[model samples]
Target: MLAVLAGCTGGSRDIGEGKPGSSGDAIQIFPRDGAEDVGPERRIEVSIPDGRLERVRVTRVEDARRQAVPGRISDDGLSWRPAGGAGRLALASKYSVEAVAVDAEGRRSARNTAFTTVVPDHRFIGYFKPENRSTVGTGMIVAFEFSRPIRDRAAVQKAIRVTADPAVEVVGHWFGRDRLDFRPAAYWKPGTEVTVEVGLRDVEGAPGVFGSQRRTVGFTVGRSQVSLVDAAGHTMQVRRDGELISTVPISAGAPKTPTYNGKMVVSEMHEVTRMDGRTVGFGGEYDIKDVPHAIRLTESGTFLHGNYWAPADTFGSLNTSHGCIGLRDVKGGGGSAPGGWFFDRTLIGDVVEVVNSPDRKVAPDNGLSGWNLSWQAWKAGSALR
Candidate 1:
């Protein structure tokens, strides 16, 4: 009956205005199938002849699941680019593409979807410190917060290096899960330059986490002034380049709360800083609320600063104070007062030893101070080649 309608037997007529073999067919995906070593963030483009790409979608690894990831179809309608999500393949197990295109008459057309393989065997981490391209005094540390914890800390520690002028060598030590610090065998030489380099790329950290840290941090070492305070002896000795420069009557912590021991590096010298007893477990059930002009000596709430409330007669004679080292000084870190003169001559990296304080040296990881760490231990935390 159809042949009779066509007026010819066994003859056929094609439908619509589209030529034979016109679009609405499967679009081709480049890179082919079963391809290996594809980057985790590869893009699959589409080719269309008589239509414009309306939408592009992707499927999960199993091919049974589908999702619409973000990407843009080129304005010319010739190519498409995949704008993967944050962390790229890190957020997805696998993905494939399914594109849709529309012709002139609002006719919809879609192509056969192609699956792309996702291999996420790569890892990355950061080596970031708080100091950003600035000169930090002895109070700052050559530190790095790793993005991932290392599988073998000893292996990674080998990649962290520190070099200083005047032939001062330092080491990198592990701090907690993801922090490492570098410090010299002694305090950095005053007026010297220090540089730290960490190469942690492709380094295997903990399970499934990789290290991607590659950076060089540099800072200048200021001055060397190592002072010794013996509360029992009722004397404080200040030395510059091994020369006995000055002596002041300095009081230290009483028996109840002593200062910390070890290589104590001067971190901050504020003319005044508010100290709260509640913050550091002082003032019993209540907080002192304010300890003014407190110079942070250690990370653990220790300060060698002016004590206006203490007896002036005990300035150089007695060890009678709270947990702080008390020195007589004006309101600022300068002027004729013994404390101010001492502060003016002191620079970063200068050492101040409170021999009788019962507290401990601040932990290397507690803050910017790194003097508590030994060079050998510091060198044992790198995760690089």
Candidate 2:
């Protein structure tokens, strides 16, 4: 019986031959197929440890509309994400993703998947400036104006970050519940690349108010151009990186309504605009229907504009008009007028440093100008220090 059992055990069945070949390293995709109710603010990530992503295509399912999801692959050829490492899918939409990758050995792998994003009950986003991809002078400030007032200022401030490529310590100062501005201790370094990141998604900004902005904006700081205005001397000196470029005669605010003496940024410029004193609280004092080469300095209606109506002799010699800086120019703002020349040369964010004026310094919240406060005092205005 033992010999019979040994003979039975020796007759083992032949196991099937191993499969012929193999597939390359598999591509990994997030939000797996059939995934439902995914967060719209979530980023789509893809990776393959042994492979480099060759192509990635994401599109809406219903209309097959291709989503412009810009992606960057790692140098090691293992992972890929949005160019900024952040993004958001469209709400209440189904997305289909297809990816192709190649391994180190040149073997290819592919993946296809689909997912749906959650439709939010409430959504909020931030409105920020200097415009994305804009180039401006060194005094640019990263300012945001939310659609709704924020109740939790500290939390909101924490979600927003301002960074410089050369690495400077940037801080935020809240002008009010709905407005926040960021800047360095001094003006931004010339030619610095500034990036503004807003990561406010799903944040409880107010009582039951949810934020849904996950965006990045970038701008370049051009040359360091600052203008020194001597209200007492009735002259303006333009400086580039601390060197005098040009000097022009000017008229500041009258003695009773002196111009604010402080550092102010050129927040805006318009070729022609109407200046009505009644609109700025000095009811019916002066109403010039069309002012040319107007550059706005403050939110409180302070402007440096071409005053063709004022007497030509008053521009260089005497202080006239209401509380505004006046330059000589024609009605249409063309030709060799000093105002047009200055306006053409200057960009937004250029600094206007007013000295020897009788009035008080401009308020920090007056437009994007006014860096008059000490660093300590400015930091004191921050919710997080």
RMSD of each: 26.9, 26.9
Separately for all candidates shown, the number of backbone clashes (residues 3 or more apart, or on different chains) is: 20, 0
Model 1 Cα lDDT, one tens digit per residue, 1-385: 1110000001011010011133223345554433444565555667666567676665443211234566677888756766755214423233445555566666544433333343344663443442333444443456655544556676567766677777765666667767766666665556667666767666666666665557676667654567887756757798877789988887676565554555566655544333333334332221111222345565555566654444567666665544457676543234577767776676544677656545565455554556655555555644431
Compared with the true structure, what per-residue lDDT tens digits does model 2 show for residues 253-370?
Answer: 6676677888888876766543444334453344443456777777666677676655677667766545577788876676588888888988888988889988888888877764
> After superposing candidate 1, which stretches have Cα over 4 Å from the reference?
1-141, 145-150, 166-168, 200-204, 210-213, 284-293, 331-334, 356-385
What is residue 12's positional error in candidate 2, in angstroms? 96
Error of 2 at 5 (Å): 99
Give me the overall lDDT of model 1. Answer: 0.52
